[model samples]
Target chain A: MSATAPRPNGAPPGAVAAARRYGEVVAPYLVLAAVWQLAALAFPSYLFPPLDAVLARFFAIVTSAKQFTDVLATLWRILAGLAGAFLIGGVIAFVMAQSRTMDRFLAPILTFFQGIPALSWVVFAIIWIHGIELRIFVIMVMTTLPAFTFQILGALRAISKDLFEMVLSFRPTRWGRFRVMVLPSILPDILTAWKVNLGNASRVVVVAELVGATGGIGYELLQQQQLFDMTGALAWTLQLVFFVLLVQRLLAWIETHAFRYRAASEHSL
Target chain B: MTAGPGRLEEPVVRFDRVTKLFERPGEGTFRAVDDLSLEIHAGTRVALLGKTGCGKSTMFNMIAGLLDPTEGTVTVNGRDPFREFDSFRGKLAVVFQNDRLLPWRTAIGNVEIGLEMLGLAPQERHDMAQRWLTQLGLGGHENDYPHALSGGMRQRVSIARAFATNAGLLLCDEPFSALDEITGQRLREEFVSLVREKRKTAVFITHSINEAFQIGDRIVVLKRPARIAYDVKISPDLDAAEKEAIRARILDELSA
Candidate 1:
């Protein structure tokens, strides 16, 4: 019962444990950085820039107003597209879960869409859509919708029948069943879906921008390549990698807090 | 019998010729409960003794309003529980074999779930859940999640959840069989005292003869297909030897 009892002084056991877990996570990245620096020393500046040079260029891009706008613009497109996919795909997934007939009808279509690559969608969007922003947004949604829908559907199906029976024994109203049972049960799955789609959204947006857009980091990367500014191109690529990692870390933090109950309960055992 | 206040003379639960059929893939229908008939009066505690797959759970589900009888009827408080399902809202609660506590919710949060479904105000529900957890010797662990607690502690939270609803009837399906003998015995004692204090009518299913004798004022043994093998009323004044004799008789019926 005193599994969670705090010590008389200093940090709680839970906090200390979390800190150690985070340290384990960061340790690999440090090793990767060391390897990258070693590899950079063996290569010429034109082909492979040193880590410090890339970092310096990354800082310059981040500090400049015009380049920063490009970064923000790409981030906005990815987020807006993700939001739309989540809303539309969530409803579709819910409908599919509730009715067998609907699920049967829609399963094939979603499967087909899932099989189609992000590059194909970007190509299709370029040919069909007029505006660069709209094209990029459409491509991101196209690439992410099926994944989100299917992942959410899988989560819905995985819910325990025992939990459902326990809730039904209470004789809750329809809304009450959804609020008290359905929603909470699927929340962890929803976070997982978001984590997956976050990577997908960022990847597809960059591809779309690289192929069709006049603005954003992808566009800047193409411009740098055409001007033979490999250093600038490498810098933008490094910035892109950092952005992805930052977003992933932020999401991981959210996931940790959101499912902290799971960690707490599991550790107590 | 130590009946609670305002105990009614009429039965609170009555199963008349109830039968349940389940369809197995590639096989024909299987009869889980076959023409079962029983009556449990208000404020009385009954233990249903049955082996695995003897349809104890099927019967328990019928009483809880989760399944309909393939034949005959099941009535709770004089209403058909399946047909009048909503009418039984807040009237009954169940403690399952496993704790079945929501892993996401804290111990007190799990306890307050029924109250939430009953539309009790958040503050009131929180306070009531806290009091119940305290009563169950889990005061400081209210904020802990189900995973954090031991199996016994989780089961206690589950019992508290059922009791906090203040339901007129409690249905327990081998609620303590998972625990060790000592913890199960301790919890059973705590549970029986709480049920007596609340004056709630309870039907508990157990395979153990000792558990039935320990918990029930009346014991109904069920054979496969769910017909009653033995129906006996237990007297509180029975001596240890008399209790042993009853246990032997129930064991014979169970084995037979």
Candidate 2:
């Protein structure tokens, strides 16, 4: 009695829709590969290596423990920098949200830090700090801290006064109130802050490594650039890109599960 | 029944010449509550009734330890609720004008908030919340979020939240004012019965005369800036004629 007839392919409607979604995800990457392959056919292999050669290098980097250590090193720097930024930013934001004087005093400083470039932080860290890991960590924290602070402060300010007062009526301990009210109230923005800062951290980590670090993906990319090996360059770049994409998908999945309480409208913004 | 909290000689809540003043941006000082002295005995329901802006909520907040009285003392259980706010950990609870359910928490989770604060074990609090939900006619809605519930159901969840803590003092600031007429009436009846059954010392804030009558045994009508204009007790044994006379007096007090 439905208006549309059954599909000729005999696939369930849900499966068909899922297939279409998967197709949408894969299409752009396929197109990019085709374009790169065409360029490889037209040019010399040094300038534009074919997709197969780039993929071969990608596997080689994945398989060789020494080469793969560079990948792991980069991953660790990105994660550690982001974690450092998030913790420092959370404290600053909490203090700022609690006191208007602190907010006024620190807001301008954070904004000023936000204006400073990642490369400048790399230089400052190299001059001011001692070690490579510490330098990259400082660069990552300085670059990403301001945005996290502002996002968390905004979330804190936007908590419902009614809900706050309701929670207060129970006379919870300071820690209890934070666990019950403050944490959940600010978690959505916290997750979003991480997602936004992840991209920034990844980019900033590479820049820091290019300047100061002797061993991360940026160092490897520098090696590729020096050798003028397009395949190696493409392979290393893909590693970072793939890492970012994987993390973004993981964050999206977390948002879905954590915020499932949100009402789903027929149309989305 | 043996009286534990109800038999205490000291007042459960006492407002000794309390006055609350809020500083407006350009209007200078706005006196929301002024020179009001009141005593709420244990196990008695008191409805502070007035027009909007009469500072009923101000008084409610004072009792709930949310606001400090600008001039005089407001004490609950013989201690200051605001200055010594943490002392009343399991002693007081509130039902606000809106449901105020945490949107991210499920119905049972919201109910378990105060229990969580009181450090009840997970299974104990879970069972307590489940029982409260069942008692409120929301037995199967323990997992529904605020957005998934209707207004009436959400308010019931809030009510369940308030009662689950088993607090001695309950402060409600027009908890039923947002619902439709029929829903409001039903909830009012249920709420009043619950309060009586639990023998809680409750301070209810409301604007409706009928709601005050339904909710409180002792009704205190307030004038502007929250001075008690007329105070009367509605005894259960009163006849219709006597009830009508008291209603007329309340009408006069409210109108005047």
Q: TM-score: which candidate is best?
A: 2
**lDDT per residue, candidate 2, B24-57, as tens digits?**
9999999999999998898999999998888988
- Expressed as tens digits, the lDDT of each residue in A91-110 for candidate 2 is 99999999999999999999
lDDT of 1: 0.89
Best by lDDT: 2
Q: Least accurate stretch of 10 residues (summed lDDT) in model 1 chain A?
A: A260-269
Backbone clashes, each candidate: 2, 0
Name the regions of candidate 2 deviating beyond 4 angstroms.
A1-3, A266-268, B1-8
lDDT by residue for model 1 (B83-190), tens: 899888889999999999988899999999999989999999999999999999999999998878999999999999999999999999999999999999999999
Which consecutive 10 residues in model 2 chain B have the weakest lDDT in total?
Answer: B1-10
Chain B alone, model 1: TM-score? 0.94
lDDT of candidate 1 over A1-269, digit per residue (tens): 39667654678779878888998989998898788778778877776667788779899989999998999898899889988888888899999999999999999999999999999998899899999888888888888899889888988898899998898999999999998888888887787887788887877777888879999988888898888877788888776677778888888888788788876435565
TM-score of each: 0.87, 0.96
